[model samples]
Target: MILPITIYGHPVLRKVAKDIDKDYPELEKFKEDMWQTMYFSDGVGLAAPQVGKSIRMFVIDCSNFADEEPELEGFKKMFVNAKITERTGEEWSMSEGCLSIPGLNEDITRPEHIKIEYYDENWEFHEDEYSGFAARVIQHEYDHLEGILFTDHCAPIKKRLLKGKLTAISKGNFKAKYRFTLAK
Candidate 1:
């Protein structure tokens, strides 16, 4: 199933997500839905909050960048109840966009490396470290679990300039190929 992504201004996007255990209802099915929704929406990453679920879960697949980064050829994983234990290395800027905030991409700066502990879709625990593009993608999705958006990291002036566009998005005035739910 392709879940409808919650658009900007959706209340759920602004709330911190809660952790879920192995007994989470239909966990496997939900994870499959998330993957379907993300792929359908042309997103490399998607978080639970973006799909109107307040749970600490997100999925990422960077295989599309395999040509550019061979290491990411098979980098696909689901993160549950993830916690970033550390962020190190110099910061770099890269353009980032979210499925929830479609048609908007901003140059966001983030650390180059991160250490995170999380459970896979099978509910198996694992702690791992990532760098470069992988780290950036992880951080972007992680922000969603913390009630933060990539635009929030933009310069003050950039935000002010984006106010009109963001308001339009909140009002369902933007175009997106995937299904979305606007704030009521």
Candidate 2:
């Protein structure tokens, strides 16, 4: 199933997500649904909170951008209970968008590299490092779990400029090709 994404202003997006253990009901099913939802929305990544689930989980698939970001070719992954131990290296700005805040895109600055510890869909633990686009993607999704949005990282002036658009999104004044649940 491709679950409906929660639109901006939904309280769930603001609350910090909780970590889930192996007993999380239907974990595998949710992961599959997350992939379907992500592909349907034409998103490279999707976080649990974006799908109205306040859990520490996210999925990333960069296959569509193989030509532009070869490093991310065939990079499809699932991160459960992920923790970013370190975000090092110089900061770089990259254009980013979110399924929650549709029709909004902005360049956000984040560290070039990160060291993360996370469990896979099977509950297998792993610790690794990432850089370039991979690191940026993970950082973006990680923010969702931390109750932070890319728009929150925008420059003061840019944030002010996006006020109208963001407000419109919050009030269900936006349109996205994919299904979504607007806050009531």
Candidate 3:
């Protein structure tokens, strides 16, 4: 099932998600649905909060970036209860966008490398290091778990300039192709 993504201004997007154990209901199915939702929404990554779930989880597929970074080829993953143990290297600015915020991209500065500990869909724990585009994607998705949006990284002036557009997105005034359920 392609879950409707929670848009900006939705309370769920502002709440820190809770971690889940293996006993969580239909864990495997939920992960599959997240993948379906992400692909259908044309997103490289999707977090639980984006789908209205307050859970510590996210999915990513960076295969489309293969041509530019062969290391990302077939880089599909499910991160559950993930935590970044280390972030090293110099900071770099890169453009980032979110499915929930739709139709906007901003240059956000983030570290060049990271080491994270997370559980796979099958519940196997793994600690891995990533860099370049891979690290950026993971960092973006990880922010969602912490109730942080990509827009939060915008410069003060940039944020003020985007205020109107952000408001419009919150009120469902934007013509977003993906259906976003407004907060009640």
Q: What is the C-alpha lDDT of each candidate?
A: 0.95, 0.93, 0.93
Distance (Å) between predicted and true CA of 21, model 1? 0.7
Each model's TM-score? 0.98, 0.96, 0.97
Best prediction by lDDT:
1
In angstroms, how far off is 87's CA in candidate 2?
Answer: 0.6
Q: What TM-score, to 2 decimals, does candidate 1 have?
A: 0.98
lDDT of 1 by residue, 1-184 (tens): 9999999999999999999998899998999999999999999999999999999999999999989889999999999999999999999999999888888999999999999999998888999999999999999999999999999999999999999989998999878998899988
User: RMSD in angstroms, all models?
Assistant: 0.7, 1.1, 0.9
Q: Candidate 2: TM-score?
A: 0.96
Query: Model 1: residues >4 Å from true position, as ranges?
Result: none
Q: Encode model 2's per-residue lDDT on 20-113: one tens digit a residue.
A: 9988999889989999999999999999999999999999987676798788888999999999999999999988999999988999999999
How many backbone clashes does every candidate have? Answer: 0, 0, 0
